[model samples]
Target: MKKPMKAALLSAFIFPGVGHFLLKKYIPGVILAGAAFAGLYFLIAKSVETALQITEKIQSGEIQFDAATISELVSGQTAGAESQLLDIALAVLLVSWLIGIADSYRVGRAQDKNVDASD
Candidate 1:
């Protein structure tokens, strides 16, 4: 397969910055990987916080230990500023992933062209 396609596939299937790393584009690879990881961290943190809150409520008898109630609580928690932050985190993750794939492919293609020209 072509270098560009290979790079794109690596980014898409492995991780957001894997392709850049493969292409020896260390700076972009680090940036993309960092952003993706930051987004994931925020998402996981929010989930854990929500779970703790629900658990506390359940333990306190404020909410029943049922699927419906838990679901409702989870939905309720995702509102206002918190929800907005979560949305932003999700967007960042997605955008970073996409940019990583496209930019890596472009860089790889350019490198391939350079190699061909030099040959």
Candidate 2:
């Protein structure tokens, strides 16, 4: 396969910055990977916090240990500012992933052209 397509596939299937790394673009790779990691960390942390809160409520008898009640609690937790923050985090991850793929592909294409010119 072409270098550009290979780089794009690496970024899409693997981590966000893998393609950039493949293209030897270390700085962009680090930046994209860091942004993706940060977003993922926030999302996981928030999910764990929500789970702990629900567990505490269940243990305290504030909420029943039923699927419906748990679902309702989860739904309630995703509201207003927190929901907005979660959305932003998701957007950040997505944007970083997309940028990594596109940029890596572009860089790879350039390298391919350079190789062709040198040949």
Candidate 3:
């Protein structure tokens, strides 16, 4: 892989999709970056926190989000596939970043060439 590709991949890996921004695919990269930091990701993280608390409660024989105790606060009835949606969105975001890395790699490779000075 070219330097630019490596740089872009490194940035995307380090910054969660900023590599695409480096490639001038601003809209997509930004959109993905934003989504990565917001919405469903946030929600699932919250769910994890909630689950943890519930687990603590379970140690006391009083779980909350447990299936038999209080049930999932965000369920299929309450939030249909929202978590799944986030997973898919992140997958797409990752893909876009990868494509950006490839493009940037190509760009870097191009930059290393000695163009004919005739023009």
Give the number of the best model, judged by lDDT: 1
TM-score of each: 0.94, 0.94, 0.45
Residues 3-55, model 2: lDDT tens digits: 89999999998989899888888999999999999999999999999999999
Find the candidate with the highest TM-score and give its number.
Answer: 2
Q: State model 3's lDDT.
A: 0.57
Off by over 4 Å in 1: none
Estimate, for each residue in 10-38, the C-alpha lDDT of model 3 and write its tens digit: 55566544665565556756665675556
- Local error of candidate 1 at residue 32 (angstroms): 0.8
Error of 3 at 61 (Å): 2.3
User: Candidate 3: worst 10 consecutive residues by lDDT?
Assistant: 110-119
Q: What order do you get sorting by TM-score, best first?
A: 2, 1, 3
Residue-level error in angstroms, candidate 2, position 50? 0.2
Q: Which residue runs of candidate 2 sit more than 4 Å off their true CA positions?
A: none
Per-residue C-alpha lDDT of model 1 across residues 33-108, encoded as one tens digit per residue: 9999999999999999999999999999998899998998899899889899999999999999999999999999
Model 3: which residue pairs collide?
A: none
For each candidate, the alpha-carbon lDDT, in order, equals: 0.94, 0.93, 0.57
Indicate whether candidate 1 or candidate 3 has the larger TM-score: 1
Clashes of 1: 0
